[model samples]
Target: MGDHEVLASTGVSELSAPGRCSQGFGVPDLNAWFRVSVWSDQGGMEAIARIRESLTLSGEG
Candidate 1:
C-alpha cells in the first residue's frame, strides 16, 4: 500500500478452525485483516495477477 491505491475493498473477517491451514494463513492468525489493491491502472492488476498465478503454481491462493 506504499505507492499503490485501494481500488477495491471487501473489509475483514475472523477465521477459526480446529485444523491446520494449507495457505499458511493460520500462522499469522493475529493479523486477520485482508486486502487487495491496484496500482493506478499502471499494470497493477496484471502484476497482481502474475503474483497470483505464481502463487497458484506453487500451491497457494
Candidate 2:
C-alpha cells in the first residue's frame, strides 16, 4: 500500500460483456480498483492485463 494501489478482477459468464470501473481517490485514501467480465469461453487474463495496463499507463499503480 504505497500510497496508491490497483485492484482488479475478471470472470466469465454465459455471455460476453465488456465492463470497466474507475474511481478517483481522495488525498487521505489513495486507492483505486477495477473489474472486468467476459464470456466464459473467452480468456480472462487478457481482460485483467488490459486493466493493469490501463492503470500503469495512468500512473496509478
Candidate 3:
C-alpha cells in the first residue's frame, strides 16, 4: 500500500469507473495455479520479462 492506497483503484481515464466489475468469462479453478511452473522457478521471472517486452512494443504497460 501507499500513502494514497484508498484511492488507488479508481479510474484514471475520464470515461471509466472503478466499481464496474464485469460479467466476465468463466472463473479459473485454484487447481490451475498449482499446475503452472511459475513463481517457484524462473518461469515467473521470464513471464515478467515477456510482459515488459510486450509493453515496450505496444507503447503501454
Best by TM-score: 2
Worst 10 residues of 2 by lDDT: 20-29
- Model 3 stretches astray by more than 4 angstroms: 1-38, 56-61
What TM-score do all the candidates reach, one by one? 0.28, 0.31, 0.24
Q: What is the lDDT of residue 26 in candidate 3?
A: 18
* Residues 1-61 of candidate 1: C-alpha lDDT, one tens digit per residue: 1222222233222135222121211113233334344443344445544544443111122
lDDT of 3 by residue, 21-51 (tens): 2111111321111111224233453553343
Candidate order (lDDT) = 2, 1, 3
* Per-residue alpha-carbon lDDT of candidate 2 for residues 1-61, written as tens digits (9 for 90 to 100): 1434454433334232443322222232344334454443354556555645565323333
TM-score winner between candidates 2 and 3: 2
The parts of candidate 2 lying over 4 Å away from their true place are 1-3, 9-34, 56-61
Clash totals in order:
0, 0, 0
